[model samples]
Target chain A: EAGVTQFPSHSVIEKGQTVTLRCDPISGHDNLYWYRRVMGKEIKFLLHFVKESKQDESGMPNNRFLAERTGGTYSTLKVQPAELEDSGVYFCASSQDGRVYGYTFGSGTRLTVV
Target chain B: LAKTTQPISMDSYEGQEVNITCSHNNIATNDYITWYQQFPSQGPRFIIQGYKTKVTNEVASLFIPADRKSSTLSLPRVSLSDTAVYYCLVGGLGTGGFKTIFGAGTRLFVKA
Candidate 1:
């Protein structure tokens, strides 16, 4: 089975630009999650998706951030009007089942907002 | 989710066993201990996990004491590839809707 894969590997944008990060989870996996880590900070959860439905989104930092999982296979995190503080690593993870094991994370997309 | 405490860094020589301990004093009854390894610019990979007692895999070993307040991850005959950050996560199995948080993690440096 292929591990989780993310797109662009790295991205750079202006402070007011919009950025989108994509994640393709393992086949048949039903759970997808998004996390972010700012410089010198711990990795924090942003949201979770079970199938096409969002299971939890309480971790999202603000209204400018949006996450979506369409058809339950892939997920996308969009940051509109990205600020300088948004420059960090965005990670996407997926698990087959919540009870059986821990999640598998992608290489992460390094976003730098200038 | 329970908070975890681990060393900020550890150093070991190649072909030696390395043990990193994590403390979760307020761990609940259902929480499980899990460890992950992460390298620079890469995502974290699962190492080992256990509830109580000892669980050993081909890659590493997880030892959780009876109190469940603390656990240790043991890597046998580690090599330079094992130099990375290790994160200790404590959470319940079915605690739906709760997020797993990764702390600062213990940075392990392997010497030649």
Candidate 2:
């Protein structure tokens, strides 16, 4: 089976610009998650989606960031008016029933805000 | 979410067994310990997980004591390819949601 797929493995945008990252999870997976890791920092959870519904969005940093999973097949994270500190590697993961087992992650999208 | 603590780095050689220990003193009853391996420019890959006792897989082994306060990930006959960052996470599927928290992680350098 094909693993999780992320688009645009790398992206660079100027500050105050907008950037969007996409994630395609495995088939039949019902849960999708978004995470980001800043340089030399731990990976932080962004939000979660369960079949088109936002299950947990408490981890979202601010209002400028928005995540949506339409139809629950794939997810997209958008950072508006991106700041320099927003640069990081964003990862997407999926699991069956959002359980601890069988959670697969994509290679990640490295975002650089200049 | 339970916070985990692990060594900042470790050194080992090829054909040697490497063990990385993590501590989660405030782990809840439903919390499980999991380990992930990450290479440069890639996302993390799951290595092993265990609630208690020992769990072994094709790639590594996870050992958790009875108290469940700590756990160890053992890599047998590690090679240069095994040199990467290892993250120890403690969490579970709660009624709220699945929130995984990662620490600084241990940078394991496998030498020749």
Candidate 3:
């Protein structure tokens, strides 16, 4: 089976612009997660979607960032008026079940805000 | 969530066994230990996870003591391709209760 896949391996945007990153999880996976890492920082969780419903979103940095999994299949993370701090690697991961199995991560989208 | 501490970096030979240890002194009763490997520009890939005792898979081995306060990830006869950043994360597997946090991770370098 194919692993989780992310779109636009690299993206460069100007500050104050908007950007959207996409992720397609493995087949039959119900747990999808979004994470990102800023420069010189560790990867941090953004949110999680269990099918079409969001299970957790406490890690979302601010109101400018939004994530949605409409069909519970693919997910999109949108950042409005992106700031310099928003530049980082955005990673999407999926797990068959919340427990007893490890998550599979995508290659990640490297966002650069200039 | 329990905080994990691991060596910042390690070096090993191409055909030598590499053991990376992570310490989680205040691990919760139901927390599981997980290890992930990340290449330069890729997201983390799960290597192994164990609650207690030893768990071995085709890729690597995860050893957790009885206390579950620490765990070791052992890669046998590592090759140059094994060089990557390894992260140890601890968390409960509940549906909506816990979140997985990634640390700086240990950077492994395999030399020929």
Candidate 4:
């Protein structure tokens, strides 16, 4: 089976600009998640999606960031007026169920905001 | 979600067994201990997970003591390819979903 696919493996944008990272999870997976890791920091949860509905978005950093899973197939994370601190690797993951099973993560998108 | 603490780094030789331990003193009753391995420029891959006692898979083994305060990930005959950052996560499914908490993790470097 094909693993999770992320678009624009690497992106560099100017500060105050907008950028969107896309993730196409494995087929038939019901749970999708977004995470980010800034330089020298551990990976941190951003949000989670169970189908088209958001399950948890408590980890979102601020109002400038938005995530969407319109058809419950693929997801996108958008950062508006990006800041230098937004530069990091963003990862997308999926799981068969939100239970005890392991999650599969994508290669991640390295975002660099100059 | 509980927090996990592990070594910053470790070194081992090829064909040797490597064990990385993680401590979660505040682990809850329903929480499960999971480990993930991540190579540079790549996302993390699942290695093994266990609630208590021991669990072994093709890639690695997870040993969780009865007290559940800590766990160890054991890799047998580690090769240079096994060199990566290993993360220990402690959490369970919440009403919304599983919000996994990742620690700094243990960086294992296997040499020839």
Candidate 5:
């Protein structure tokens, strides 16, 4: 049980730059999710993927944000033209099937958009 | 989707039983109550979950009243490592979508 793993535990980029966060879920897990926590705010869901197809992405902030799960294995969240508000922690989670309970979350990627 | 309310912070001593209650009066019938623990610079981990009555695990216990208006997460004989933020989430996996919303969370500081 490796749990969920996230790449680039921390990332720093200039405003208007592009930064992509990656997540590798546990083996044989078909359900993957993305969540973000802004400064002084609660963690919010960004999107979810069941295998390679996106099951739900209604939580995405705006057009600049994009999430993809290639080959139904790993997920990537890309933020283009990042803004100052984009500085926050992005968390990835996974569960069996589409169950809401018993989800395992990644340590999260701290993105600092300067 | 049911919104949850919990304390902003709590303080307890080692070897003492800690109880943190969450209010979710509008919780739906199909929704479940789940609690998570998070350390500094770490992701949230599942502790316990219950829909009604009581549920116990090696790590913690979840108590839900008959009305299901609220739920309590009890940590027994906590240690310094238990000092972290605890989150209470209430959501149902409806076809509409998943509504797992995290609140401010209660920061439990365990002292020796």
Candidate 6:
């Protein structure tokens, strides 16, 4: 099976700009998750989706960040008015069942806000 | 989520058995211990998961004691390619009502 795929492995944007990251989950995966890691910090969860409905989004840092899973297959995270602090690697993951099985993670999109 | 503590880094050599341990003193009964390996510039890959006793797979073996507060990941005859950061995660990978966190993983440097 194909692993979770993330696009634009790296992105550089100016401050106050908008950046959108994309992820394509493995086929038949219903549970998709978003995680991020800033420099010198641990990988942290951003949100989770079960099909097209969000299951948990408590990890999102602020209102400027928005995530959507339109078809229950792929997901996108948009960071508006990006700040310098928003620079980090955004990761996407998918699972057969999050509670029971392990999740597969994408290579991650390295975002930089200048 | 239970907080985990592991060695910040370790050094091993080729053909040597390596054991990395993680301590989670406040682990709950329903929580499971999982290990993931992340190569440089890549995402984390699940190594193994176990609740109690021992679980072995083609890649590595996970040993959990009766207490479940601590777990060990054992790799046999590791090669240089085995060098990577190993993260020990504690808690249920539940669909709801769960906080996902990653502790400072153990960086294993396998020498030739």
Off by over 4 Å in 4: none
User: Which is better, 5 or 6, measured by DockQ?
Assistant: 6
Off by over 4 Å in 2: B94-96
Docking class of 2: medium
Q: Residue A44 of candidate 5: its Cα lDDT?
A: 95
TM-score of each: 0.97, 0.97, 0.97, 0.97, 0.97, 0.97
lDDT of 2 by residue, A9-110 (tens): 999999999999999999998889999998878899999888899999989999999999988898999999899999999999988777765679999999
What DockQ do the predictions score, one after another?
0.66, 0.66, 0.68, 0.65, 0.65, 0.67
Question: What's the i-RMS of each model?
Answer: 2.0, 1.9, 1.8, 2.1, 2.0, 2.0
Q: Residue B19: error of model 3 in Å? A: 0.9
Provide the lDDT at A25 for model 3.
96
Q: Per-residue lDDT of B48-94 in model 3, one digit per residue for the tens?
A: 98889999999999999898889999999999999999999998976
Model 6 alpha-carbon drift over 4 Å, by segment: B93-97
Candidate 6 i-RMS: 2.0
**DockQ: which is higher, 1 or 6?**
6
lDDT of 4 by residue, B20-81 (tens): 99999999999988899999989999888888999999999999989999999999999999
Task: Residues B7-81, candidate 5: write the lDDT tens digits.
Answer: 999999999999999999999998889999999899999888888999998999999999999999999999998
Which digits, one per residue and each the tens of the lDDT, describe model 2 over residues B1-112? 7999999999999999999999999999999898999999888998888899999999999999999999999999999999999999998854446789989999999999
**Number of clashes recorded per candidate:** 0, 0, 0, 0, 0, 0
lDDT of 5 by residue, A1-114 (tens): 798999989999999999999999998988899999999999999988888888888899999999999899999999999999999999999987666665899999999999
lDDT of each: 0.91, 0.92, 0.91, 0.92, 0.92, 0.91
Q: How many clashes does the backbone of model 4 have?
A: 0
